[model samples]
Target: MNNKSITAFTLLTATLLFSLIAHADIINTNTTGRNTFSHRLSNLYIPEAVGGETWFDDQNQYNKLDIVASGTAAYADITVAGTVVGTTAEGANIYATDNSGIGIAYELNYSTPGATSPQYAYVYPNKLTFNGSGYSLNGYMHLKYALVRLTQFVPAGPITQLPTVTVNYHNLGASGYPDLSVVTLQGISAQPQITACNINAPGSITLPPVNGNSLVEGAQGITDAPQITLTNCPGAINNIIYDFAATYYNTHSYVNGIFTTKQGDGYAKNVYIQLQDATGTGIHINSPLTLPGYTGSGNYAIPNFRIAYFIDSGTLNTVTAGKVETAIDFTVIYN
Candidate 1:
């Protein structure tokens, strides 16, 4: 979890999602000569799991009178906008804590109303989590939050230190004032580090088969008994997205989901390549493949994955003994 807070928001505007009658007085929290507020939501460093909670306190006590005589103080839809790359809003499992405590009483519901609409389903004055399907995030992620009461709100305890709403009376010869304040929420933005990996020796992969003819004739092809190691990648990278390409072997390029070698000008015919994970499982070059278990902090070495040249005896019928060589381009990436 290489999570870092890239920036902070100086101001936020309140927006009304549902129509509500106006009667309650509005007071600025910034009246105290302070326009900025800070919230430490560092817990969102890594996206919260589907059933996790990202706790946060607005640091503001709710004390606004009902605009409709029965309305309560509540926060509404979390409006999300701004630029995101590598993953879509749907791909990123973003969710807010709808209830209190450990959030275990109710089942987890992972849903979003497309990208345009702000995601809702949480009570106000609580914490929110990016509760979306797990995906390593890249580029920038920003979310805007707003508050609105949906129903009558009752404080668990006494309300104190609220601003004053004054009214004067001449006929009745009495004056009364109510404590009041506005609910202003802050926005959050983060930029987690991208996935990176360094290969040991990527220039040339030489496969020394037992013999050109016997190599293709044998039932099993060559294996990376001594795996080529990869190192220095972020711990968040659980898997690698990779593909292989070879112009000469373009006709017989993809074999068993692995990239293959080309028909050389020399002896090897119908020759191809096969890639396996550290566990010896064939890696599908078309999609992302899980990397070896990371140790949190250290260079990651892939001990199981290896590549070897194989000849399709059935197609070529004859395996040439002279020169069995073909160039291959191996590309590795983590999503």
Candidate 2:
């Protein structure tokens, strides 16, 4: 089903409802120097369906160590039903794995105690489509179907590199769901490039229905379709560097021209407008990056906005204009 159908995470819901598996990517997150990739979210996002189980507890077995333990790797895994019917499959091998020491208890919210988490209790998101109910055969399956979410986390140090992720949301229908898979990203340009009317308008971004060389397997909606926005490093040659963030939609508006970044995290990248305004301009920094701006307009001009990220020098540079609107989006890529 589509991401919207994936449902919200309520308490320990996704964990108890579906068949589960937990495992870590054999690959570990890369850590170098200077903290370039630190503070960025992983491209991979756990489905609400997979939230809340005891599969990923830091204390259960994963060694109370954070996902970024022993370096900077965020680790977790899933267990699939692997059959037409689920929950009570006879002789079904529980194919999930976690970090070498972690038990099924280390989870997305295991670390943040006393704080609200996306996972908790038994409330499920409205996004998922459950074609069939999973029940343990003779009460055995329900006991083992418990699982947990795989969350990407930063433990203590800064990150230098981000693990590349390719997420595919599968299936749009209510039943007979689609599956998710990673695919090689492609397409320099795509069809559906819509135009605009005003200077603030971003025109349109062309995105294929599915990302990479292969199609999505079980889920659907914006998950399958991925857009690639390249914010080239300005003036930096030889060692190529750029900032990247993956999201569901191609071009997203802030609903009210309002966006917020955490204060201490040091994350305030530019909103790289792909198709600059009709006047060949794009917005960055928002001038008063922390202040409010006009997002509403009676005019037909659609102010283009996306959760875009642009590269910074890693260390803060002397700023005359504060952290607000650095320049039009293109400035980050073009000299």
The weakest ten consecutive residues by lDDT in model 2 span 135-144
TM-scores across all candidates?
Answer: 0.38, 0.14
- How far in Å is the alpha carbon of 125 misplaced in model 1? 21
lDDT, candidate 1, equals 0.34
Candidate 2 positional error at 170, Å: 50
Q: Which candidate is the best by lDDT?
A: 1
Shift of residue 64 alpha carbon in model 1, Å = 23
lDDT of 1 by residue, 19-108 (tens): 856322211222212122322222222222323233322334122211111112211122222221122122332222221111111011
Model 1, stretches more than 4 Å misplaced? Answer: 1-190, 209-226, 235-248, 251-258, 276-282, 295-297, 327-335
| 1-335: candidate 2 lDDT, tens digit per residue | 65565667767645457765432111111211111111111222222232323331111211121121111112122222222111112222222222111011111222233221232322211011111122111110001122223332211111222122122223332313224333211111111111121223233333223222332222112111123232211110112112222132222223222223222234233322232222333333223221122111112212333422222233223211112221223211111
Mark the regions of model 2 whose C-alpha exceeds 4 Å error after superposition.
1-54, 57-275, 278-335
